[model samples]
Target: MAARTITNRKARHEYHVDETYEAGIALTGTEIKSIRAGKANLQDSYARVENGELILYNMHISPYEQGNRFNHEPKRPRKLLMHKREIMRLLGQTREKGFSLIPLKLYFKNSWVKVELALARGKKKYDKREDIAARDAKREMDRAMKNRHRE
Candidate 1:
């Protein structure tokens, strides 16, 4: 494993993920180089099934600093490779009400660039508030436990 991670922080904050899939990404040489340099962003990116194929949009791989005219586009749509059945299943899930495809994270596994795509539904306003409150409470409880252990 190359041990690189490109995370979509906002995705977790804004949506409730129901399922996840790992899919390979097709990339140019320069794009791979940029990713190896940790110059990729999945923050505003998303994946969609288009014409029976999965395509990732708005995923930014910064131009290779050393490549002059051969650098890949910073925000081009990249094709995601997966089994036909898996793509069809995702298409069906996304076609259902309140379901979407979100790029959760990008990483390299055994030299292959892979993306973790989430089958998600948008979180309502009150749901987001409750999630925040739960997270805060958990943090406070952990802190209290740590203090008690130290004393």
Candidate 2:
């Protein structure tokens, strides 16, 4: 089966990602089921190093439709599994000013749920404007190139 991915589109627009890491997530049975059905959202989700562990906050995995009272919470803080050394390194990096851990995507990797986490710095308003302008220019150039090739 192909991998199903849930992405945080706003994360890229809001932050300048510097590094990325793949980490496993601790999920309950219902949560996994919900994710497999593409009922998950990574919007506004972020990770933080706390007491030697990396914890994910604000991730929303919708409750399974068939699940009853045992259904998992839609929004919960989940733990991200990574090596101690890596966690320590991330902690160190995040300690610097403006650096934060953001969840970029969630997907199934070989039957295991994996999270693509990024170490990023928040972008300023002008930076966002610049990115938008550059993207518009790139789009126009691509359109021109496509027309030229077709002509």
Candidate 3:
């Protein structure tokens, strides 16, 4: 099966990602069907270490239309599978200095569902403006260079 990736672009703009980790997600049967149909949303989704286990919250997977009473909850907390040591390390970082664990994306790896998690810090308003300015400057320079080469 082809690998499918669903990404949260807003997370990149709103947070400074310092590190990334891949983790397996515990999904229900109907939820998996919904995800395979590209009906999952990572926006506003985040992970936290709870009781020594990582739990994902606010992640929405639309209920399968074909599913009747067996449909899964759209916004249920899901467990993430990771090593004990990794979870412990992330717990420390997330507790300090306005750090958080955000889910960057979800994808299928050889039929198993995986999430791309990040250790991130929230971006300030000025930092966001600076990044926009830099991006605009780079675009303008590239346009200038292209026109110059054409002349």
lDDT of 1 by residue, 1-151 (tens): 3557989999988999999999999999999888988999998888899999999999988999999888888999999999999999999999999998999989989889999999999999999999999999999999999999999
- Location of the lowest summed lDDT over 10 successive residues in candidate 1: 1-10
Better of 1 and 2 by lDDT: 2
Q: Mind sharing the TM-score for model 1?
A: 0.96
Local distance difference test, candidate 3? 0.95
> Number of the top candidate by lDDT?
2
Off by over 4 Å in 1: 1-3
Off by over 4 Å in 3: 1-3
Candidate lDDT values, in order = 0.93, 0.95, 0.95
Candidate 2: regions farther than 4 A off: 1-3
**TM-scores across all candidates?**
0.96, 0.96, 0.94
Give me the overall lDDT of model 2: 0.95
lDDT of 2 at 35: 90
Please identify which of the two predictions, 1 or 3, would achieve the higher lDDT against the true structure.
3
Candidate 2 residue pairs in clash (backbone atoms < 3 Å): none
Ranking 2 against 3 by TM-score, winner = 2
Residues 1-151, model 2: lDDT tens digits: 3547999999999999999999999999999988998989999889999999999999989899999999998888999999999999999999999999999999998899999999999999999999999999999999999999998
